[model samples]
Target chain A: MVFLSFVNCMRVKGPDKFWKRRQILKLAAHFYGRKRNCYSIAIRSVQKALQHAAYGRKVKKLERINLWKERITAACEELNIPYPLLMENLARCDIALSKKTLADLAIWEPRTFKCLTQIAAAKNQSYPPTVKAALQPPPEGVITRGML
Target chain B: MNRPISTYKRVQQWAVFGRLWFLFDAKWQNPFDSAEKIAKYLAGKHKPIYHPLSDVGDHVVVINTKDIALPNKEWRYRMYYHHTGFAGGSSWTSAWELHNKDQTKVLWKAVYKACGGSLLRHNMMERLHLFPDDKIPQELMENISDHMKQLRPVPKALHEYTEEEIKNFPKVFEWPEDYVLN
Candidate 1:
């Protein structure tokens, strides 16, 4: 009697069964035809969609960062400067502005952006200018440069 | 004995070159000079820290390319060449024929050739946009900070007449009833 009572089986369906199906079907209403009405298909799609939704929220943050980087680069160009140079100079001068802040200045405040560019331009680089000379137009083919 | 000289020097060399967004109005401007400016910005040559290997450049939005000025009779003489690697499939089209088909192509080609296939040129080309008219995409519009001074003033339309002006104009020359201008 104890062993028989201990054994649980899904043979007998209860209110929980219909409740689970109803929840899935309701969520799947936006889906086409059978996925909404058919419990089996609805279960599969809703499962996948929930997984995608969870992953998408994480990716949205990275996408916004990339957009800010592009905006900042474009803004720097408006003042006739390069993005990397501005970043380096700002860091050298101990200005801890973020990409979002720089991008905002590029779009909303042109004069301020220009001022920042001038400050960066004034801070001269100590490296041999030849580092830039390496940036010549390459002949359109395989390059065999042994030196880094 | 000197205070961290090597670290400071290295930091200065690697510092970021701030990018700028420029607007180029191709309307009625000499195509050659416009192309030169486009290439310079595309290659990031306008900066002191510009390196061919590094993508340190500005974005350029070019508008009104339809009205680009071509000097002399280059419209008839200038040619765009293309070829297919086959038995016989080479073709050459005049500037006028090409521009009529797509107004932005002329300036686009000019910037491409000016870059001369440099390291940063292809990525820089991604930053260079060409539009036939002033209608820019909303996303690109946000970054535009300043415009290059126009080379020549946009001329007033010679033959255009407003609807109200046409209605009010006095019919100075009267023709016979049978005479149809058409």
Candidate 2:
């Protein structure tokens, strides 16, 4: 059956659909011995394999942010603090932590993240009684600050 | 301890690049223990060539922005701000926001704030680069070989992590866990 397709099939899936020619050659080299069939059915097969690898990278990128979010949420949850609270305190303190960096710490350096939570908690606790209201100050405050 | 600013032959050009070194003080304490020390260390002022008015500063690069340590309660209280020219435009951003929002700018602000804001300071800052984490683009690495005398080998773990490792770490989910649960 495979032999019949090779002989009779008019459909010659152009290499362009697979990838750039250079990439196709790389795939071909990895799959079959580098020199034997530089361009053939074997090369096409290798291109398919290469396409799969590319997909794996794409999938990983899509999920990277999600994983970081999970790590941060986990760290926050364990500390009895929600992610939003931790973020708010940091913002209130003018502590700049990139999401990428925070996500990284939340995973690989939990100790550091715990310290961050402690800091935020301390900041929150140190606040005067009208704390929750301060997060989003009244329109009056906004007017005074913005227009008045 | 003053030394003339050293120059290395330029091998490549880059719009951005950063370098970090793990260093210990004479007493063996982490020199990076305080932001002041870190500011001094990166400023190259410890060297004899350190001059206040001259552009003798090295184009220091810093990685691991997140791993940087702070003394006592500094992290909790440090507030960053932005000006909008209007009276109410003075909005405060935190160190965390600066670090997380666009960390490169945070490093820029930190360095500028440390160096005593001046026109010359901007020139010095143009050379300093910071990444949120330790990763640098491959193209930047190619240019660095031209100007640097000593180059640190990129860590092996960084190569393996490639945004893929984040997915593999063990995960456990449980309900009834907290204040806000959906």
Candidate 3:
């Protein structure tokens, strides 16, 4: 690690460039053609891929939320309750369940979801005529203003 | 994990992912509305474990599709379009015309449209079994363990009502003796 002049000393990069290019090349190993082996090309593709990987992490979360909402909505529809009504009523009832949990219950524990819908439906006074007709009597041990 | 606990977990996983056959009686139901619900089940959106890439959709046995009711004059005005991918190859078929040609086509088309243009649309459609009437095959009937509630109740026509029901109907006011019946 000796430089002949101040100019050469300034030109030297810290540590080694091999490891730097190796890091980028590792990520670009699966890339095609020159992108996999060429340092300049691999660095560009690696940076772009890393950016996409970062963005996809956030997108994955939102997509899961959307899917949970869809599943919950489907379950609500099957029970003759609108998604909003069920969510509002559940919140009002102090039943703080996340969309993920509700969706899980809807599929794996449908009977439990049905009971939740019944509680929600019972709490609300106004309902669509068709849903009203289809509504079952509220479960025992729970009373709402509508019942009173 | 212990062997017994691992076996129990495996069984739980199977139970959670198992597909069920749904029975939807489409008699007197609006096909468009019914299709929306049917599409949900067909796509397995009703399940917590549903993933767009996973093949977890349930089978739907839709009976009495021939008797589906269309709102307004949709049967006359709603047209299904087809194209042969050539010049002057496009054709339009009315809902009624399509239904007449095949009793299940109208509802099938409605469900197809309801499923949207996802890559999984055809896969979901394969799970739907549309019967023109209630005469479902024994194998399919045996698979159905749950029924989808109809969106609307079937209305009873005057002739369909019993004599006792008509006689017991409350009248707002009796027709005046002098009033002549139309």
- Write down the TM-score of every candidate: 0.44, 0.32, 0.77
* Model 3, residue pairs in steric clash: none
Ranking by DockQ: 3, 1, 2
Clashes of each: 24, 26, 0
Per residue, candidate 2 scores C-alpha lDDT tens digits across B1-182 of 96644344232212112333322211211113333444553554533223345344454555555554444554566777779999889988776666567745544565567766566666666655566576767755554432221222334565577576766656795446565854
Question: Measured against the native two-chain assembly using Cα atoms, what DockQ does each of the candidate structures obtain, in the order listed?
Answer: 0.02, 0.01, 0.48
Q: Poorest 10 consecutive residues of model 2 chain B by lDDT?
A: B22-31
Compared with the true structure, what per-residue lDDT tens digits does model 3 show for residues B22-114?
A: 999999999999999999899888765778888889999999988999999999999999999999999999999999999999999889999
When summed lDDT is taken over every stretch of 10 residues in candidate 1 chain B, the lowest stretch is B45-54
lDDT values for all models: 0.76, 0.55, 0.87
Candidate 1 residue runs with Cα over 4 Å from true position: A1-148, B1-16, B153-182
lDDT of 3 by residue, A1-148 (tens): 8566878557666878899889889999999999999999888889899999999999999998998998888777667688998898788778999999998899878999998888877666434335654575554555565542
TM-score of chain A of each: 0.65, 0.46, 0.77
**Whole-model lDDT for model 2 versus the true structure?**
0.55
The residue-level lDDT of candidate 1 at B1 comes to 75
